[model samples]
Target chain A: MSDAPREIDALIEMMARLPGLGPRSARRAVLYLIQKRSVLMAPLAQAMADVARTVRECANCGNIGTSDLCAICSSEKRATGEICVVEDVADLWAMERAGAFRGRYHVLGGTLSALDAVGPEELRIPRLIVRIAEENVTEVILALNATVDGQTTAHYIAEALEGTGVRITSLAQGVPIGGELDYLDDGTIGAALKARKSF
Target chain B: MSDAPREIDALIEMMARLPGLGPRSARRAVLYLIQKRSVLMAPLAQAMADVARTVRECANCGNIGTSDLCAICSSEKRATGEICVVEDVADLWAMERAGAFRGRYHVLGGTLSALDAVGPEELRIPRLIVRIAEENVTEVILALNATVDGQTTAHYIAEALEGTGVRITSLAQGVPIGGELDYLDDGTIGAALKARKSF
Candidate 1:
């Protein structure tokens, strides 16, 4: 016996389908939206409609944008002769937030998985190879996750790009900034020790 | 340097303003929505628009519905000569989920608060009194939260209805049905002990 109107109940169900939201939280969010309908919910609905109409994946790099090419891929200033390959758009966004990588990104969409039957062709791997040649890319930075599947995909990409004259590298593993030694995982501690650099 | 398109970024920003979502989770949710655009995002947007267009507050009970009178307020079977007064629509929804009470509900919008300057006029107290007389209501159940403001509002309502001849009662205080004694807070423990019942 739901107290909310039918439309509101439907809205809550749909919201629960979104990432990071459960049925309980979705109900709470819907109630909050109804309470602030004029201020927040209306604007959010308009924004969602606008984004649904205009948003698209960048044709060249698989990044999301309103244009054929994403802002980073289209920008002249970001056309560094290097490409950073990431597992998904979230990782690309994380890298962008860091503000350290000036080179454009290639979102693989997802890592390879034998169990899931995902292969290089299923992702943007072939497109990435073509971009490396077309853009005169000097380096291919494999910024995949540290998961087993991510590492496997990285190794596969590295092998595929062999003899292409493109320098391939990956993100260095070490102790993270602001990380406490006591809270560090055994694997991270071991990696930090093995990759010890001269201070 | 955001990797997403301008419209997509704006969508993420708006989603971040939702009650439970932060900037990071908003970005993730946006990316997920974009990925499932045809199936999930489009439907969600349409639902939001439909709700925004059709949904309105029930004039009689302040419950959000598609019409002037909400389903409960308009139902003849629900006119059981009792009214459950709640602080917000969420509380009303919670009560409905319980399926315990058969009578209608009156949403007060919020509790009385001297610090925030909320008064009886701001809530539905006057309307509640009017309903008691018009409907010949026998019982007025106060199902407000246990916060100081909620209790203050309850007491104020009880005093206002002193001469109205309608029976006024509040929800009981005790250990919750599934609550663990060890995990119970000091205040809850004290209340449970004071309200201890015979087997």
Candidate 2:
């Protein structure tokens, strides 16, 4: 019978809307918070609230931050001529973790998708173009996902910048160093075969 | 070689401290956010900040809220004679999804843990006793976890409230409906056997 309080229902509804949380999972998460009121729940709520209040989008590179302009953009050292372009923030963070690339980043937001009706106008493509000329960027790494949409967007960008003379490169494709041939699907096998190296 | 910016390291350290997140996962997650700044990272950061500013602890029940008290504790209609006492908010939320109980709740925060030096005073036990007297409650259901510490804490509370005259009960232990025997663990089977009925 109708057991949950009205307020609980509201909380559950909002939680269910989360990316990975369904109604059942949302209920469990809420209950866990109630039980760990002092330790887990209270702290989580506080953190959530704090982030909600102070977080904003960086105007230049589209990174998230407390200020209008993100720390990377404001930093004079990161204003190198090379700008690495990526499809998502996660990829940008990955490059940072690797500690390899010295230049800054330009997040593309997402790959262009004909199925989803997503276009260059919908992404940060225009802003990226402006940054290319204004920032005097020399090399642009097309660090997009391996998906078809990602490749399509990459090709489109490379074609558009034909006269700009900026060197464009992409992450190599082939058998992943750690990948087991047994685990790969047929399409992956075909891709790896086509991109095989002389070594 | 010192590759990443100093601010990046600081951010990674904080991320590693999140529950279910290790350094490896944190690295991956950070990378993801950076790449998808406009579509994902920016929005996620904004949401986090917004929640942080608005979130506060409930004065009465200790639930998370944007105001003084959470919606459940503020509603007078929820002051039913029954109160389900659970070890965590997650359990409370689970019960809510089941839609089985119609009364308010008492979140115990956590079970008594001698190893961690956690005691009744550290939990919401005192608050619960006060609620029983002030709210004129008739029933107090123990909905704690099945762990050893959880049961010990339950017995302690039951003894403490000897003269309180509140009816106490627990969820029945047995073979969960539609659960396969092969999938059932030893403890579940033992509980089901002990609580077996004359069928």
Residue lDDT tens for model 1, B6-108? 7777788888888799988898898888888889888899898888778888887788899989999889888669999999988999999998999999999
Name the TM-score of candidate 1: 0.97
CAPRI-style class, candidate 2: incorrect
Task: List DockQ, one per candidate, in order.
Answer: 0.71, 0.14
Give each model's whole-structure lDDT: 0.89, 0.70
lDDT of 1 at A117: 92
lDDT of 1 by residue, A1-199 (tens): 3568778888999999989999888988888877778887888888888888888888999888888988889899996699999999899989988889999999999999989999889998999889988999999999999889999999999999999999999999989999998999999899999999998
Candidate chain B TM-scores, in order:
0.96, 0.89
Please write out the lDDT profile of model 2 over residues A76-143, one tens digit for every residue: 87757888888866677677768777787887878898888888887788888888899899888888
Report the C-alpha displacement of residue A144, candidate 1, in angstroms.
1.0
